[model samples]
Target chain A: MKTRLTGRVWKYGDDVNTDVIFPGKYTYSIADPREMALHALEDLDPGFVAAVRPGDIIVAGKNWGCGSSREQAVVCLKEAGVGAIVARSFARIYFRNAINQALPIVTCDAVDGVENGDEITIDFAAGTVKTPRRVFTFPPLPAEVLEIIEDGGLIPHVRKQLGR
Target chain B: MGKTFAEKVLAQKAGLQQITAGQIVTVKPDRLLTHDNTSAIAATFRKIGVARVADPSMNVIVLDHVTPAANETYAISHQATRAFVAEQEIAAFYDIGEGICHQVLPEKGHAWPGAVIVGSDSHTPTAGAFGAFAAGIGRTEAAAVMATGEIWLRVPESIRVQLHGTLPARVSAKDVSLYLIGLLRADGADYCSVEFAGEAINAMSVGERMTLTNMSAEMGAKNAVVEPDEKTLAWLAGRVTQPFAPVYADADATYASVIEMDTTTLAPQVACPHTVDNVAPITEVAGKRVDQVLIGTCTNGRLEDLRAAAEILRGKHIARSVRLLILPASREILQAALAEGIITDLIAAGATLLNPGCGPCLGAHQGCLAPGEAVLSTSNRNFKGRMGSKDAAIYLGSPATAAATALTGVITDPREV
Candidate 1:
């Protein structure tokens, strides 16, 4: 896992739900992770999949991913190569899903300073987000949660625990 | 200081005498729930090299989403789930037509007071209405729980909401929930354990309490509960025969925040398209055109909810321009409605009765909308494109509001009707 990530920001407002992140209609139809990436944010931002680059960060307002417990919502974005997400807050299930998928999530107010296409750096080691204008610090993740992420999410972590 | 309900429960589950908010503890949940997604979770479980589930009896699998196999893909998924259930000897499997996972879980006695339950669906918190510490988990973690029979949870700070006063006629628990969601906003109670109390909550039926807890997910609650009373015990008398202790917050429990509301004059509430918190009083959006009206899903699809709609539509046909759809949350609810003659009344009133499952609420099939059309539903969500075309709209209201709207072919105030 990368301790620091630099990416262009894709910003959004509050209540960016899973329905728009990965449309529910295609849930059962799409089984391939690569195929799932094609539809990320298809409803909320039609151009997201085409324009997003690997390691791009998503900056959003409060309550990001506030609907559904579909892991595909996180899987699609992770497969799309999103490096991290910075939001004021996130729905509980989505937060857990992201960690399980090894997608970096930061809870902070850095969204206020970032804009679309602006370069930002998330330094997990320092628990800070560096925007072009300013730097915002967030509380560091727990050691156990950080270990799960470092092990490339919960699946691999659990596999290692089981000595697989 | 006294401990809150969440603290008390987590502590007990962890085999500790005390625990505080924000501390992480690993405990074995009493039950784990999965719906149609059980197929995907089963695949992940295999990847973990676990040939057998740690505890098959602890798992509850239900086939509800996109039931009857909307297409071959869904059919294959359900088939795989059945195979997994058979192989694992999972005794708590509920096939299609059993109803939604949330509704089926408790009815089958999987949920009870003080139980720690985790599910792969967001509405898993609906079981909290039974006084369980239930929360939604992701598919991957669900697989891990299956392999390890343990889960790590962060004890959440508690929010106490006290309700008082009698609800006016034409007002219901759905209205009270909508009013709270509107007041709290979408993220007001983020990651908090919400506790409902006072005389108003005590007066509500178990189904009504379930509606409140189910809608709590909309406001980002980790879990929500109403303390178990004689009413809860009465509802679970035969279903939950096991001896279990219930947990409650101490009188002086510390809370993150406390809110109080009087429901005597609450009006029917409506959440507009695009966001659950984007709410308005029914009067504000009344007379708005609606092409369809739906009354079902885990949110408001209980027997009482159907009866509420039928009462309004009894001996009255819906408007010609509108299509009214009714789905009972479970086969049990369907049978109860039929026995009560509620289904006949609704069908005679120009409503289409779908099977007892999650029909069209997720937009996978059944009644998707056309662009520029608007539907008023009793479901929990109204996100853009939630039902069909991105350009279409979804409005959320109580079952009473849905019945009145179907009768008028537009959004209508239930009280006014």
Candidate 2:
């Protein structure tokens, strides 16, 4: 697992719920992550699907992923090749689901200074993100949480621990 | 030192001598709930290369989200679930038209005091009303639990919500929940366990308490619990056969914060469009024209909720310009309403009754809104595009408020009626 990532930014406001991340109506019909990727953020920004480049990161305000506990919301972002998500705060379930899916997310209050399309590099292990102009620091993840991320998620981590 | 209800429950489940906030621990819950998306979970479980569920009897599956096959895809999903249930020999399985999972699980004795329950749906905390530790997990987590019978959790700090004073006539559990949501600010209690106490909460019926726990997720609570007492025991008398002891917070239990709410002065409240935290008193948003009124969900679909609506709509018809849709939370509740004539009273008052399931609530199907319409709902959540169209607006209120709005074709205050 890579601890360093560089990507373009896609900025979003507060309370970006699961409904906009991946619509509820599509819950049943979609299963493939690539198929789910096509509709990611479709409701909030219709052009997001087309404009999003691989390795683009999402920078959001407080309470990002604040609706249903749908893992598809995290899956879609990972499938769409989102490098990482940086938000001021996160709804608890989304934060956990992202960890389960091995999606990198950082909480930084300075997200407001990062503009859309700004090229940024993040050293997750160092808890620092740098833009062309400045650097922002977030608390490093707990050692156990980092272990799960390094193993590519809980499923794999459990497998390794169980020696299965 | 005293332990909070969540701390006590997690400690027992984790087989630890003691546990505190922020410590990560693994627990095998007494029950795991998956509804509507059981097929997806089954697929995930198989993909994980697990031979079989760790304990089939510990898992309960329900078909309520899009029952009666809204489309071929849903029908196929249901078929897959049936096959999976048969293959796994799952102990409890509720088919279509049975009822919503949150309602049926407790009705069938899956919830009890001091029990730890996790479900795939966000509203799983509804069972916490029984003094149990219940929370929601995502599909992959559910699948992982199915395989190993255990999941990890970071112990949450507890918040004490003391309810004092009596509720006004027009005010119901729905109002209390919305009022709390306003104070919690959507993320005020995020990642924390909420413990309900005081006179008002003790005086509330089991159904009312369920409403409170169900909406705890709206404020991002990890779980919501009410300590079981004589009232709780009485409600669980015949409904639950399992033997369990109640867990209570110690007097000296450390708490993150304490919030006190007096219900006597509380009036009917509504959560305005786009966000649940966007709430205001009924009087402030009254007179906004409504195109539809929906009364039911896992949140407010119990028998007491339907009876409240029937009382308000007894002889009066809904406004000609307004559409009213009623859904009972469970099949048993629907049958009880039919016997009590609550269903007839609602229909006679011009309300359309839909099958017992979660269709319109999640914008899946059944009474979807047209663009630019406004609706008053008794269900939880009013996010933009929640009920089909982003252009439409949503107002969440009590069943009484929904009934009043149905009759007047506007966001009329229940008290005014």
Compute the lDDT for candidate 1. 0.93
Residue-wise C-alpha lDDT for candidate 1, range B275-366, written one tens digit per residue = 88889999899989999999999999999999999989999999999999998999999999999999999999999988878898989888
Among all windows of ten consecutive residues in candidate 2 chain A, which has the lowest summed lDDT? A155-164
The alpha-carbon deviation from the true structure for residue A141 of candidate 1, after best TM-score superposition, in angstroms, is 0.2
In model 2, where do residues sit more than 4 Å from their true spots?
A: none
Kindly report which residue pairs in candidate 2 clash with one another.
none
C-alpha displacement of B367 in model 2, angstroms? Answer: 1.0
> Distance (Å) between predicted and true CA of B21, model 2?
0.4
Q: Report the C-alpha displacement of residue B55, candidate 2, in angstroms.
A: 0.7
- Best by the lDDT measure: 1
lDDT of 1 by residue, A1-164 (tens): 78889999999998899999998898877889999999999999999999999999999999999998888999999899898999999888999999999999999988899889999999988999999989999998889898899999999999999999
User: Where does model 1 exceed 4 Å of error?
Assistant: none
DockQ of each: 0.86, 0.69
Against the hidden reference, what TM-scores do the models get? 0.99, 0.98
